[model samples]
Target: MTDMPPLILWFRRDLRLADNPMLAEAAQTGCPLLPVFVLDPETESLGAAARWRLGEALVAFSQALAAKGLRLHLARGAAGEVLERLARATGASGLWWGRLYDAPAVARDSAVKARLRGLGIEAKSFPGHLLHEPFGIQTSGGGGYRVFTPFWNAIRARDPGPARPGPARLRGWDGDPGAGERLADWRLGQAMRRGAAVVARHALIGETAARDRLHDFLHGPVADYPARRDRLDRRACSGLSEPLAWGEIGPREIWHAARSVMEGAQDPGVDSGSDSGAAAFLRQLGWRDFAWHLLYHFPQMGARNWRAEWDAFPWRGDSAEAEAWRRGRTGEPVVDAAMRELYATGRMHNRARMIVASYLTKHLLTDWRLGLDWFADCLTDWDPAANALNWQWVAGSGPDAAPFFRIFNPQSQAQKFDPEGRYRDHWLKGVGADDFYAAAPLRWRLDPAAPPPVPLIGLAEGRARALAAWNAGKA
Candidate 1:
């Protein structure tokens, strides 16, 4: 409505068209907008697999937008520099985007905001990623909570409001690009050579697909989530992590959808079973929020252990044990399957994640950071906060930390949760053998072996060695 041309909606992590507060607010201005995605090369440093997933998400977003008469303007270089040039070329008055809490994102955003203001271009960030902003939830004494239960309790007591979907239509603005690497030229998936094919085989990306997946999970597995969530082989959990991580789906949307079913009952006068599944699923979302809170309050959490005592813990540095864990050859089927599954599909079941994390840290006595880095490189759904938080949890160094002695016995875990060996055989079969490297994804292929290497230390011995290392480090 104002004389200012539409603000450029600089798309980042919040990629979807629905339940996006920033996009909704920006659209209310009636300004013609430039939807832009900056493919900064710095992202390349994260991992080729991560970049590959990101590129696919973007391409899906671009195609969806194009169908609706809007095309995503892809650009590359430092974010600030790219935005400045974009502003100059498009004659745009401002930039707007959903906020991200990761350290790298925080650094880039701070610099970009200052530079945009300096250039007389308005820039604003909105809390479209997490339900409550990172700084929103805190303790009674006005400090961060270092434990999960208390932190989660604090969050549970609060209310996350209704979801806001994006505007149905936009009077899209034409924009000039200063520079951009062609999507194909970026070749984010070149390392895998079959990256897109791999992702397509398992996970589906994009708004509509995410919504459908959420609905499917709700109608079935969600009802039993509290009991079955940790089951590695069962479709016991929502496969929503990839979408949620990429912001292809927002927590707000998921929250409300699950709540609707849970709140509905044949007898409205009293509470019913409806709230159970919703409550359980919401708890996971709470954990996700808590992870972000930890990262925000303790910025060092992304890289350092939450517990200072654990800092003294000696960790195996890329040793054979570490290598064995990576190949799922730790003589632990559950752990190996998890690692192998991560390699094959760029994801792992939540239970599998914890199981493998425990094997790496408490069982193998390797640094949690090593496992976290590998996940960051390979996981299609890797969230900086969630990934780091969970790793530290298993290492007995995070908020509401797992006790060091609580090691996961992988065989028992598999027998209990994956009793049928369905998950194990699925991944193992995919690679032709338990240790077949020839057919394995290149990411999992270590040291040029014909078949993938098999397990080294038996489960019991690995556990003993890992615990001994922890005790030694403590002493």
Candidate 2:
């Protein structure tokens, strides 16, 4: 073993190697690299689905590191303490890591940096999780942009540069690394009730798999994205959200892929379709960037409304109706199908997400936080900034939020999007296959063997009530 002190690379959400900024920069330093991952409180507290996904991702990442002749040392406890102990034990010279946007993460990372600097061990953080650092963006007035259009326009216009390639091979610290906890002991999956078995089958892990999926979409399905992104019955989406959230893939990589298609670069992955489709799909990464932008500037959005005036807006506290909404028992075919899809596969279509969020916040008059937490528990791709921001956007409580006066009629939404009950037939078990095809032109074709759940509240009544509350608050 070499006597030289190693530079520690602490893995957090940015789990993958390729396109990882911290890994790339550290490799350039030519220091012996020691890889470590800490399962601290914030990580430990993730909802069941997220925890389950993280566990699977870690297993894949560990194997990926092993292939590079490296080990991802796992430790449990406060991250600062764990890193300090590990550094002292190993005679490490410094620590390097990627940044996280959430309030808790920022606090923890700041504290860790200060402590390490105090000890004269270098600690540096890099940007790998997002195309732009949340704090780096600002308006002409030097304040955060509360509007998304301008935010997107500004970020989209600026170049993010290319993603750095992962090291061809890593020089792992040739030292006596101490015992770190086995991944199995974490039990991140056991907290889940629907059984992580289902989510595991659905999740696509590892960086290579994520990159291949991006390439496949750029080649074939992306051309249809503009015309059919909201079609619930079709496979027009990239399905890269979870990997993006887990940092298995970077946004710059996806941005580059879509930009390549837009630029007329022909590859095996590009289908004969419109470049406009590729350009439209690239907006998703922009939205992800805007989510973090909002979170960093308005951290209170985590538990409160972005528009504080809406705080007094009445919401149904805890009730059987809310429980039904959460369980896919709301008797609304589109909403039920979406919730069930989330529970069974750990994901739902993007269109379905908006529909279900509308049903919970406006139709049932439930608080947006309930829907947000349930999603956090059920979605493999659960991202703090996006999930919170989107839930509030649908609830009419966030920046550039949908107007409270506007409500999605699930019946009409499914009709316009699902059209032929194709998506409903596959997911909604309430109706007999025959009845579903034969039912009225729109939703609820199924003759649920069990009586279709009665509507928790009449949509008209709920909509009217929500409007009254919102109007009163405004008045």
Each candidate's TM vs. the true structure? 0.92, 0.93
Whole-model Cα lDDT of every candidate shown, in order: 0.78, 0.84
On lDDT, the leading prediction is 2
lDDT of 2 by residue, 376-418 (tens): 9889999999998999999998999999878999999999999
| Candidate 2 backbone clash number | 7
Task: Give the CA lDDT, 0 to 100, for residue 311 in model 2.
Answer: 84
Write model 1 residue lDDT over 161-268, tens digit each, in one string.
Answer: 668775788767754444556788888887656545655577668898999999998888877887888777777888898989889999989887876767672212
Worst 10 residues of 1 by lDDT: 265-274
Kindly provide the TM-score of model 1 when superposed on the true structure, using C-alpha atoms. Answer: 0.92
Error of 1 at 292 (Å): 0.7
Angstrom error of the Cα, residue 47, model 2: value is 0.2
Q: What is residue 460's positional error in candidate 2, in angstroms?
A: 1.9
